[model samples]
Target: MADRLDYGEGTDAQQFVFLLPEYLKDTSKKMKTGLMFVKLVNPCSGEGALYLFSMCLQQLFEIKLFKEKHHSWFINQSVQSGGLLYFATPIDPLFLLLHYLIKADKEGKFQPLDQVVVDDMFPNCILLLKLPELEKLLQHVTEEKEIDKKKYYKYSREKTLKWLGKKVNQTMAALKTSNINVGARVQSNAFFSSHQISSDKEEDYICYAHGLISDYIPKELNDDLSKYLKLPEPSASLPKPPSKVAAQRQKRNK
Candidate 1:
């Protein structure tokens, strides 16, 4: 058989398993950023990609913020479907990941899974959002009491573009940095073992919540995923991902 990828929930849903470190195995102690597993019920299509990509960004935000001292903002569109907007800081991802991870862990979602596969699934898409545009959305959403769905989508699209443009500019600047100092130095090590080191050579920039970089995944992996995903074509507006060296540098910096 196909190894029955279904995790009791359904076949369409993808379940990711994360082994908790020995320190996190204790239920009595609380973890600030420990995730056991994650389940994506969305279909593996464009729509599903959007939500999954958003989740990856959230995780990256949390990882890069505490470890790298970078910060950004995000609002869960799924939560805001009821017309109430809740802006979250990058730190919020710690809690968000915990919530989903706990649920999946309890149900043994996709138990006995390969950790490598799960790790590879992350950074599937890099979104370059402008900090100022995020600020604008935060201001607008907080001040406004009632927002229709139509207006929300329209506003999100507009602001997202502005954010992406600014993000591109920032990445370009980082690449041009003669000293090669991407941002503030990170004293502490990353919590996740898969964290990448930044490369010396500049490539495409993935404007994540905490900071920006490129080559989140291996070239072969990206090429494979490209077969299924209709990712945005490389354009002046959208920068390409960095080379393998840049990815290594990202890991080292992390």
Candidate 2:
């Protein structure tokens, strides 16, 4: 006779155990039952796979419960009128299930109970399971044993040095052309001035001097001077040329 079957809530809505049929326990009738019992007791190998499978089953069963509720209310209406039903949205859970299944299969646990529960809940659940492409990419990275630290450091250092050199060259070139008195004597005179220049006037004088020097210096000479200093390239790009319209207006006035 079939074993008396009883289903009750476990710790959570998803947690439940099924009492085996009496025939399943009869070792002479089925050797598969013994194998299944052993697997149930020792699930470490396929734990991840089973966990994911169970989650999917719970989600799918929840969807089925909603479908049943809808059916009860809309008995007169068509099943299609119940609206669309999704076991899990956001796609993450489905992907996780697929990942675990792949791992389980790789580990050689083909008939995991979690997988069984998922299959029982939705016969077409395999259709929903998708291969995680990102997981495949991650696996490739994880499987690689060797890392080229020296090559990485070499490239990083080269890039950093190139950037720093460019900035320093520019700064030195600006300092060379500036009227800020780099010479010790001039700097001392400026610092100990009995009649100091006003801040506004000093700024105006610096700007005017810089403009004059910039106008007088040839492009080639400026480049050579900058190269000699071995400083970083300038932070500021050269100013744009005067507009053709402005130039034409100046020529007309002349």
- What are the lDDT scores of the predictions, listed in order? 0.28, 0.29
Q: Tens-digit lDDT track for model 2 on 171-214?
A: 33543443222222232112222224322233223332232233
The residue-by-residue lDDT of candidate 1 on 187-213, one tens digit each, is: 222112212344432322232211232
Cα TM-score per model: 0.28, 0.16
- Over 4 Å off in model 2, which ranges? 1-65, 68-88, 93-132, 135-254
Off by over 4 Å in 1: 1-24, 29-154, 178-240, 243-254
Each candidate's number of clashing pairs is 16, 11
Please give the distance, in angstroms, between residue 118's alpha carbon in candidate 1 and its true position after superposition: 23
Best by lDDT: 2
